[model samples]
Target chain A: MNTIRLAVDGVNKIYAGQATRVVAVEDASAAFAEGSVTAIMGPSGSGKTTLLSILGLILKPSNGRVTLMGRDVTDLDEARLPELRRQHIGFIFQSFNLFSALSALENVLVALQLKKVARPEAEAAARSALSRVGLEQRMRFYPRDLSGGEKQRVSIARALATNAPIILADEPTANLDSHTGLAIIDLLAELAREQGRTVVVVTHDTRMQEHVDHTLRMEDGRVYEN
Target chain B: MTYPVPMARRNLFHERVRLAITLVGIAFSVVLILVQMGVYLGMMNNTSSIIDHTEADLWVTARNNSNFDFSLPFPEHRENTAKGVEDVLWVKKFILVWSLMKLDGGGSENVEIVGFDPETGIGGPWEMVAGDPRDVKYPKGVIVDESSFAKLGVAKVGDDREIYGSRVRVVGICRGAKRITTAPILFTSYKTAQELNPWMAGKTVFLLVKTAPGADVAEVQQRLRAVMNLEDVYTQADFAWATKKYWTLSTGIGLGFGFTILMAIFVGAVIVSQTIYSATIEHLREFGTLKALGAENRTVYGIILQQALLSGLMGYAIGLAINLVISDLYRRTGQLVVQPWQLFAADLVVTLATCVAASLISVRRAMQVDPMEVFRA
Candidate 1:
């Protein structure tokens, strides 16, 4: 009976071209409950990433209503969307998009800073998040100096430091090997079950099905529950 | 919150080679601007060197006199008229006429004869390296500055030279007296000047007047202007400025310098804009990531602008230091290159403005980045 934290009803995204129109996401409808992990799996060009983008408030859905905490946010002002995203949702990208100029701890601190958090408090939170990811000894190491697994952990710590209620990860472990990818999946699951935070992941790895609470499949720009 | 990441600083220094190239470009622009401006100022100062060094409070000259260097001679009675003014302390007849100096090798060069009353030393050389200003009172005696040694072909004191078919001895050598036309200046007495140039027998080019202590110089200038109705009357400062303006505006020198300065700024802006734009393109993914993390456009622009400003400040410092060393070298060679504090302030403003304008291109490119690009494999 966990309350639904994020839900989209009949959401559609269309990219209009001069010569033709492409439907990136069509009639996608789903609800992600609180303190549960949901996985959306699809092949290449299956619209999973497009759906994640819409849910992350990055792209506007052409026709649908997006509800966050029972409040309809489909028609919010464009300027207010960034603040809404910063305050409520955190995103983890597939390729581990950490700033190359910053160190591991600074990468996490930047997310908190974007949310207008104070310096000492943000530092403490960033350190705690890095420690939770078992990277306490490598806080000062840059991305180029760290391995692929370590870089992904830093990115996760960046998402965690913001203290948002919902986390959306897009292919978070696609670059890691089999062993490291499984470890990342387990880490996302633990974050959801233990901390009671909603976690939505768009990934193609079949191994993700065994750990998530619910699974959905996407094909040809359409979504279906599995 | 003090920007705990120092993202701008880190990004600017991330690539050492690119940073070095950018700094060099900025520094070159700054140096070019300062050097051109300094030289222009120095040349303007030289145009009024005689008027500036003299202790005159007012000058009475012919109505058609264009500048101090090119003046038409008025009657000597104007000296008496200036003396009749109430606040006038004393008046001395002055002569400035171009003549030819017959070199020992039979190659004659242009020279300017500055004739003043040797007894009062009013319009004579102010800085002397050898002998005395009063030495010009001797028959056919002339004092020349050390700066004109090579041009006039006279090395030291007592060297002989001919002026307009008249024999004259160089009795004294002065320093720091310069002419805008690169002609050697010869300081002599009124009698010697008239003897050297027979056409200047009963005419004087200027009447140098000094005001009494505690007297208003403006009042004396007004009274002299009223008394000498047919001639032009100018205070010392106004006359000096007139000479400087004649050289700066009447001649095309100012326009030439201005064009050079503008070109330097344009070149500098291009260098900075290309460098910053390339850097932004290289970090396109990082910029997209920041946008996805909900950073506002202002935050991203602030980082880029900060990088530009840092580059400007560092480059200005290095360029100013180099200019100082070059200015000292020029001074040693007896060339004036003026760098006042106001010039430094203006240079700083120009540098920062150039840097900011250059950053706008990068900012535009950064703002168009799509946050969703970070999700691409």
Candidate 2:
């Protein structure tokens, strides 16, 4: 029997600007199990990214309880949230948020180092992660020197090096061509099936649905199974 | 071993031209302050060179005399009075006068004429490069410092020169007897110096007194003051300090250099702070990402501070190298480079202060960056 790695019950997110207030996520409930790849699909401004941000602990829901691996993290102290994210949740942004000055290997090493991994183990793990992403030869290249697909792959390696049980990717292939995007989706699916990791991907692209176990279609601020 | 250090170094060295310009600006400021400070220290050292080189327990000058160069003549019998003081080992009469030296081509140069009892070697020129101290015992014999050889237009020993219309022959060339006020020192016997200046014929300008070994110099100074009755008495060190104070505080040299150094510090700090701040701004996204990746605020601050310290160390080394070359080129002035250890120690303290102060704004900016911004497109 599979285990539930992350669950959000009656989650809501409201973004209040100086002149307006808009609800980004509303009463959304979802559960991601170990060894499953789930995609939250929606159009622009459909609150898909907000829901994923909540799941990654980047944003706290206005009214919700979030549990990760049997621990309730929704009410966790803000100071301790980063530690939780570092130990349990790995994040991949759409822009591939890689440090421009660091090489691909160093980029992956940063995540492991943040988890307080020893230097020797971190280096070996970084090399292995880059190699797993088919980027062993390009590990010394900086982000600026990388192509769109290679940069995204390096970001994937960085997230993977954290050894986090849950991986939250926000539109991981939005900037790539269809072929590259498909390859990235396949890579995420491989992590779920082969490594037994829980993967939740937020994107507007429906092509991502083909590789995941299921899709949750979000419209406005409400989420429903598709 | 820390992540911030390598990240900071890579960011600073990423653009070679920018890094070079930044280092040059910092080094230029460091040299500016050092040279200004060096000139001030050189002047202070020069004012005290005479007292420092001479060995004496007490100096008796005409009342109210502020420096040795400006001393006026008092009764010659005061030297005998100092000799009678308790613990006084011996006393010798000395004279100093500004004499006009007649050049071969009819050009005249003003030189400081110092006269001493050559037999006792009291108040005599120290560090002779050629000729003997006893050579000044000969009639019409004098000593000229090598530093003033070119200025006085004279060759080595045996060259005849006229001062105050009285003929004199150079018997020795000395080193390390450099004088401030741009006056070359000419050492001679007390009788010849008196013959050269008629107004000082029956008087002595200074009385050099030495106390017995194991004697307290301060007590001897007091005894000489009481015995002389109408002359100011000072130990050698005290007299040198008074001379230095006159030049440094009363002559406006100290204030002038102080202002320049202050301006250099401000200019150096401003340039470093702005450069580091802009560099941090350029890497704000990276900092935000690091924060989002669970790096603490201290870690981000470490990167800015590391960059500043590295810049300061490099700039200090470059500045000192360039200063040494400049000092060597102008060493003939004898007042350009004085104290090496003091200047280097002061440079280190100022450089660290400047660079550390410079990084504060950058560190603050880095900490203010929100990790959540990394999610923004």
Candidate 3:
């Protein structure tokens, strides 16, 4: 059996307002194994993104415990949580989220620099990461100069450059055409399987299930595995 | 890990038009504050230059003398009394009178008539740009400052001008004898000044006393005060301070300059804060992305602070370069000017502080950026 790189037990997330309380995730529990690709699939408002956010440590559960590499982080202080996130988690956003001011190589290098990698090594690592995504030729282009697939590839390179064991991608293919989206998913799955890192992708695209080791369907804030 | 410098430079330079406008605003504020301060300093220097440049160790004036502008005169015998004081190597009778000058053309100009004893040449124009100081001893002789040559309608030595209807020849021309009262000054012998202003015939407005080397100035002042019995005894520095204090605090010029300075500061802070705040808002999503990438609040603050300081530094350099040109223009106007290094250093600190203060609003907004927006968007 593969080692479980991350797990969340009985996690719940709710947004409280003066007049109402909205529950984003309810009793969502799942274990993502190392060296495998997992897809959390659900329709809109089904809490798939919320579960991904919680797993990425961007949002804290209203009630639950989170385990990362065998350590519980449910009670981690907010001040120290970012440091922990930088050291362990890498994220690929739906909008690509590349810094428009930076070139593709700098976008990746900035992420590595934030991860506390030295400049010289960060440059080498950024180049290698961009090459891994077949974007070496486009590494010097700004996000505005690049196409949709190129931008997505730059973000993937940014996430990969961090060398974190857990990569969380939210609706990674939502803005891409099917062919480009499939190509990205295939690259991600191969990188995860070959590099022994866990990749959890949140999506409603049923085609994503074909390339992942397992699919966990989310509905109304609840999770069920297939 | 530490891309604050590059990040700030890129962010500020991204929009060239906005960047130029922001820099211009900052530079204008700096220049306004600096020029206002320079003018005030120039005014102070003009007010005290007569005393500062003179070679007198002790000055004796009327007991309630407010300033050189409206000086009160005492009996000429006070000079003899001061001369008797121990350590008083020499004493010269000094006179000052405000009189109308009969210009060569139709109109008349206001003139400050300053008279010093020709024997000692004390309290006389020190910077002789042309001609000899001794020539003022000639009949109805006078010396005009080079800076006031154009205003006095005289070109060179041997040029003639009339003061209080007396045709006085400009025996010499000197520089840096600046006027604070907006009137050009004409230097003459005590006898000629006394003859011109009959009211000053038997009186002297001031006694310029020189002390021997190693003589205690305070002791000489004490002895002169006791000997004269009715005049105020002042060291050179005390009289200069008194003159400066009267012009700066007694008059409203200081308040006017001070108010303008505060306004400049307000305008600068507003412009800088608005520019930086607007830029931050424009890049709100970028900062959100940084937070999502696990950057701490301190990191965001660092970035904003770096941006502000960068603008301040560049703006300050540009402002100073412009000030150099402005100072030259001011110098041509014949105003007393001094820009010590300390002023530049202090202004630099103030400029940086202004920029830092202006960045607080932006930094607060930047720190509150929600990393979740990167995903939600």
The true-versus-predicted C-alpha distance at residue A19 of model 3, in Å, is 2.1
Off by over 4 Å in 1: B1-3, B84-89, B211-229
Q: Please give, for residues B1-377, the per-residue lDDT of candidate 2 as tens digits.
A: 34422887887888667678778878888888888777777777877777787778788889988886778899898777887889999888889888899888888998988888888777888888899777888888999987677678755888889887788999998877777677888888898888888888889988888899999998888777777779899888889988888887877788888888888888888888988888889889888777777777787888889889988888889988888877776585555467579788988888878999989988888877765677777
lDDT of 2 at B258: 85
- Superpose all Cα atoms of candidate 2 onto the true structure and report the RMSD in Å to 1 decimal: 3.1
- Give lDDT tens digits, candidate 2, residues A1-226: 6899999999999988999999999999999999999999988888988888788877889998898898899988887877888888887888999988788988898888778898888888888889888899998898989999999999999988878888989899999999999999999999999988899999878888788997999999999999
Docking class of 2: acceptable
Residues A1-226, candidate 1: write the lDDT tens digits.
Answer: 9999899999999989999999988999999989999999989898999999988888889999898877899999878887888988888888899999889999999999889898889989999999999899999999999999999999999988998889999998899999999999999999999988899999989999999999989998899999
TM-score of each: 0.94, 0.90, 0.94
Candidate 1's TM-score reads 0.94
- In model 1, the Cα lDDT at residue A64 comes to 97
Instruction: Compare the candidates by lDDT and give the number of the best one.
Output: 1
Error (Å) of candidate 2 at residue B11 is: 1.5
Single out the weakest 10-residue window by summed lDDT for candidate 3 chain B. B1-10
Docking band of candidate 1: medium
**Candidate 2 TM-score for chain A:** 0.97
B174-199: candidate 1 lDDT, tens digit per residue? 97678877788889998789889999
The stretch of ten residues in a row with the least summed lDDT in candidate 1 chain B is: B1-10
